[model samples]
Target chain A: MNPEKVNLEQKLSRFDEHWSPKVVGELNGQHVKLVKLLGEFVWHHHDEEDELFLVVGGRFRMEYRDREEWIEPGEFVVVPRGVEHRPVAEEEAHVMLFEPASTVNTGSAGGGMTVADLDRI
Target chain B: MNPEKVNLEQKLSRFDEHWSPKVVGELNGQHVKLVKLLGEFVWHHHDEEDELFLVVGGRFRMEYRDREEWIEPGEFVVVPRGVEHRPVAEEEAHVMLFEPASTVNTGSAGGGMTVADLDRI
Candidate 1:
């Protein structure tokens, strides 16, 4: 087994595209992904998987059905399964996502923003 | 459902004890824990669960069976199940752990450093 250390900053630097998630690491059937966000993401809900969003840089507002939460650097927000939410960022935001390997970016509301093939950074 | 944002820095500030882990959040049956580590830790290995060590502050060296890996801030190391490892920190190090809710601090080598009841920050 390769016990290499995964550097978040280095992996994040490898990509520059927004909304496209690049896999940084994997453990226990979960994929740790790095993504750049700008503007607004589509409202979607995952029926069977919860998603964790950890802000690496910048800030973003996560809008839920009943309320909105601001996630800044070093902060994280967990969107539970089956809950509708949208992430909006004024500036470029770097985020690390932890979820099951089978989880899709657009969830059940898959459309053009849906990324089927994620590149491993 | 409480869709609260977890501030890692704030959660880490709430505890100062070394080797003790405080839960910050939970998702998909896994607990996100913040722990302060100082000095050397006991060598142990989980029989059935893999562990993720994400360095939030300071630095530490993870001693594995064959080699030692130095983990610094913004770097993460994953220890696979049943792999013998020990974590050592020259100075105070803050880390965020992601593992199953039932994961024990001491793993199979339970001793005085073993913490059973982890406080939720």
Candidate 2:
């Protein structure tokens, strides 16, 4: 009752940086984040967390060690813990990520795109 | 990588039961469920689990003791644990719910509408 409703489109419009996830909602010790993705991300794996990527706009490609899948809008793919993966977007893609509050964007493969400190919108 | 991609619309089409939630995906000890709602739901509260309701198609309403909010497509609302709430949908509304695997559709308010054993889609 206290928390307000969140609109995905309105939340997506507040940021533009690629791979930078902004926390939009939190529940059950998990943070629901919104990230605008473009190009290819660093290959990484969350040693302690499983990440759920739901495409809100455009398309997202989840590349695993064995295969890759294209996730269109309204579709989601879950990358389980300890599984190496990378996300690639041909164009600007709006993604909603669900994971623990401690999850990092780059995961174990920290790089320039690593967002250690995320801001809640 | 072991988990498959889930399409919201495709999953919603598999069931037509009202107030009954079907699990579509699971991650990090949580379950992603889809339920179609019509009319009003029982007032209930989850003592230990927070519930997130994300509207995928049509519209929904989250009614609390004091106020209520209309949730349209692309909108979501998080009802914290122990907060009494009820969902109302004048028309058929497709919703995606994210909560712990132990969550029951009726919460603490058990009745004929309570679905204890949910089927996975």
Candidate 3:
């Protein structure tokens, strides 16, 4: 089997759209996605799947019901299932999200930010 | 719920042992581990779980049965289940491994490098 190496920086350079996640790799039942986040995202929660957010570049603030956590480069946070949270980035931030393949971008709060069909970069 | 942020660099700084994986975070049924790799690892393959290797710093070469793939910083390679592979790093490399919690470090070709109990950093 030919194991292809996925360069995150190169894959990230292929896209400039914010909030739209592009699949970079897959393992087991999970999909590794790269997204450029800016401004604020909708407050939502995954009812059945946990989401892993890793900051590849820049910084983002993860706002929960109680407090806000700043995720800087080389930092990661795991939002467990059913936990309401929102991500806000003051500037363009490169992020890597690891979750189940079936996970939606908007979670329960589907809106314009919802990406039903994700692009692979 | 308090979402604690896991800093990869800070966690990696807590340990310097090579090949021994330290758990940094957990998502679903998988464990996100950080390991420092130097020199060559033993040839091995996981029978029931696929392994995701992301190079956090430096570079490493993945030697497969037929060819070798160089993984540099910000690059990742997923070794599918049951595929034979050996990771070789000429210099010290920082890497993050994502796989099932039960994944053995040495896979089927277990030897002294096999870590039955992983430490959480």
Give the TM-scores of the predictions, in the order they appear: 0.97, 0.98, 0.98
RMSD each, Å: 1.0, 1.0, 0.9
lDDT of 3 at A6: 95
lDDT of 1 at B14: 87
True interface contacts retained by model 3:
0.83
lDDT of 3 by residue, A24-63 (tens): 8999999999999999999999998899999999999999
Give the whole-model CA lDDT for all candidates, comma-separated. 0.92, 0.91, 0.93
Give the top-scoring candidate (lDDT): 3
Candidate 3 wrongly placed segments (more than 4 Å)? none
* Candidate 3 structure quality by residue, lDDT tens digits, B56-120: 99999999999999999999999999899999999999999999888999999999999899999
DockQ-wise, the better of 1 and 3 is 3
Assign candidate 1 its CAPRI class.
Answer: medium
Residues A37-115, candidate 1: write the lDDT tens digits: 9999999999999999999899999998788989999999988999999999999999999898899999989999999
Off by over 4 Å in 1: none
| Poorest 10 consecutive residues by lDDT, candidate 1 chain B | B7-16
Lowest-lDDT window of 10 residues in candidate 3 chain B? Answer: B1-10
lDDT of 2 by residue, A7-106 (tens): 9999888877888899999999999999999999999999999899999899988888888889999999888999999999999899999999889888
- For model 1, report DockQ: 0.80
